[model samples]
Target: MATYIIGDIHGCYDELQSLLTQAQFNQNTDELWFTGDLITRGPKSLETLRFIKGLGDTAKIVLGNHDLHLLSINEGIFPNHKKDNLTPIFEAPDCNTLLTWLRFQPLMRRHPAFKFALVHAGVYPRWSLKKAEKLAKEIEVQLQSENYKQLLIDMYGGAPCSWSNNLTGIKRMRFIINAFTRMRYCLPDGSLDFKNKLSPEQTNNANLTPWYEAITLKPNRSILFGHWASLMGKVNKSNIYGLDTGCVWGNSLTMLRWEDKKYFSVPSTIK
Candidate 1:
C-alpha cells in the first residue's frame, strides 16, 4: 500500500478528485496524508470536508491556519470575511461533526520509518524534534478539550516572535500555533517574520530568511510542509518539500508519493 501526501487543498474538491484519479488512489489500500488548509477560498468547502472526514483511518492531516480560523469563527472569536468561501461549510448539516474532527487533528505528525515529519508550515527554529512534538501535543490537548473556545479566542495575532522555553499560557500556545501553521520567513536571529510572503529568492528584506534556511534539523530528518504557495513546490534544500501549488488560486494541486519520492499534479478545475 502506497502513501501519498497532498498539498493545501483549500476546498478544491474537483481538483482533489482529479489528483487522486491521476494517482490512481486506492482508498481501500493506499493512505492519504493532507498538508491541510482543507477548507476555504475554493468552491467546494463542504464537499471537501465531508469527503476527507469520510476517509477515516485512510487519511492523516496536520491543521493549517485556515483550518484554525474556521474553528475560531465557529466559536465567534473571529469574523468571517465576505471574500472567504466558508459559508457552504458553515451551513452544512454535518458542520459540527466536521469541525470537531478538524479540531482533534494534530499540528504535526512524524513517520520514523519514512524519516520525515509533516506539518502545515515549518517548525520553530529553536525547537528540537522532541520539544516541538511535546509542545504540539500541549496545544492539541487544549484544542480537543472543552475549553477549546478559549484556545481559539487566544490563538490569533503575531507577537513574542522569538521562542523562549519560559513562555507560558496563551503566549506559548500562540507561538506554537504560528510556527506550525503560519510561519514563512524568519528574521536572522531565528524570530518569526510574519511580514514576508515572497519566495525566498524574491524577498527584498536583507534580514529575512525562509525559516528552513536559518535552522538545522536533525540529521537525515526531512520536513514536508505546505501553506507557502508562493514557493510553488520549490525549495533549494533536498530534504524540504513545499507541496502547496496554489490550487485554490487556480493553479495545480500537487501530491508527492513518499516511497519513490515522486510528484503528481492536476490543474485546478475552478475558473
Candidate 2:
C-alpha cells in the first residue's frame, strides 16, 4: 500500500485526477494525505469537495485557510473576501455537505510510523509537535460543538500576535487557527506577521523570518505543508516539505510519495 501526500488542491479537480493518474494511485491499496485548501479559487469546488469526501478513510485532510473561509461564509460568520471567486461552490446543491466535511477536518495530524507531521499551513516556531497536537484538538472540540458558529464568527483578526498561556475565549481560538491555517512569515520574537505574502527574499522587512526558519523544536522530525505557493515546489531542508505548487494559479499540482520520497506532478488546467 502506497501513501501519497498531495499539495493544496484549491478545487482544481481535473489536475488532481491527473496527478493521481501520474502517481498510479490505487484507491483500494493506497492512502492519500491532502495538505488542504480542498476548495475555492478554481472552477469546480463542488466536484473537488465531493471527490475527496467520497474517499472516506482512504484519505486524510487537514483544514486550510480557504476551507475555513468557506465554512465561515456558509455559517454567515465572515462575508466572502471581495477578491474571492467562490460562487460555484456557494451555489452548488451539495454545498452543505461540502462545508460539513470541511469543518470536520483537523488542523493538524502526526503519523509516528512515518515520523512526519501534516498540517495545512505550518506549525508555529514556538510550539513543539506535542503542543501543536494538543492545541489542534482544543479547536477541534469547539468546531464540533454547538458554539461552533459563534467561534467561527470570532475566528478572524491578527491580534494577540505572540502566544501567551493567559489568552482565553475567542482571542485564543483565533490565534490558534491563524497559526495553524494562515501562518507564513513571523517576527523574530515568534509573533505572526500576516501582512507579507511575498517570497522571503523579495521582502524588505528585516525583522521577519519564515516559520520554518524560526522553528526550534523536534529538529529530527519532518513537516509537510502547503499555503505558501510562492515557494513553488521547494523542500527547503531535508526535514521540511513545502508542497503548494500553485495549482490554483495555473501551475502544476504536486504529490510526494512518503515511503520512497518520490514526487509526481501534473500541470493544472487553470489559466
> Best lDDT goes to which candidate?
1
Clash-forming residue pairs, model 1? none
Regions of model 2 farther than 4 Å from truth? 80-85, 217-220
Model 2 weakest 10-residue run by lDDT: 76-85
| Tens-place lDDT digits, model 2, residues 1-271 | 9989999998889999988988889999999999989878787777888898999999999999888888888887767763566777788888877777778889998876887999988999889898999999999999988888988888888987889878898888989999999999888777998888887767788998889888865666989999999888664677899999999999889999999999998888987
User: What is each predicted model's overall lDDT from 0 to 1?
Assistant: 0.90, 0.87
After the best TM-score superposition of candidate 1, give how far the Cα of residue 233 lies from its true spot, in angstroms.
0.8
lDDT of 1 by residue, 108-224 (tens): 998868878899998887787778889999999999999899999888889878888899999999999999999998887778988778897787788888887766876789889
RMSD of each: 1.1, 1.6
Give candidate 1 regions above 4 Å deviation. none
- Model 2's lDDT to the true fold? 0.87
TM values, all candidates: 0.97, 0.95
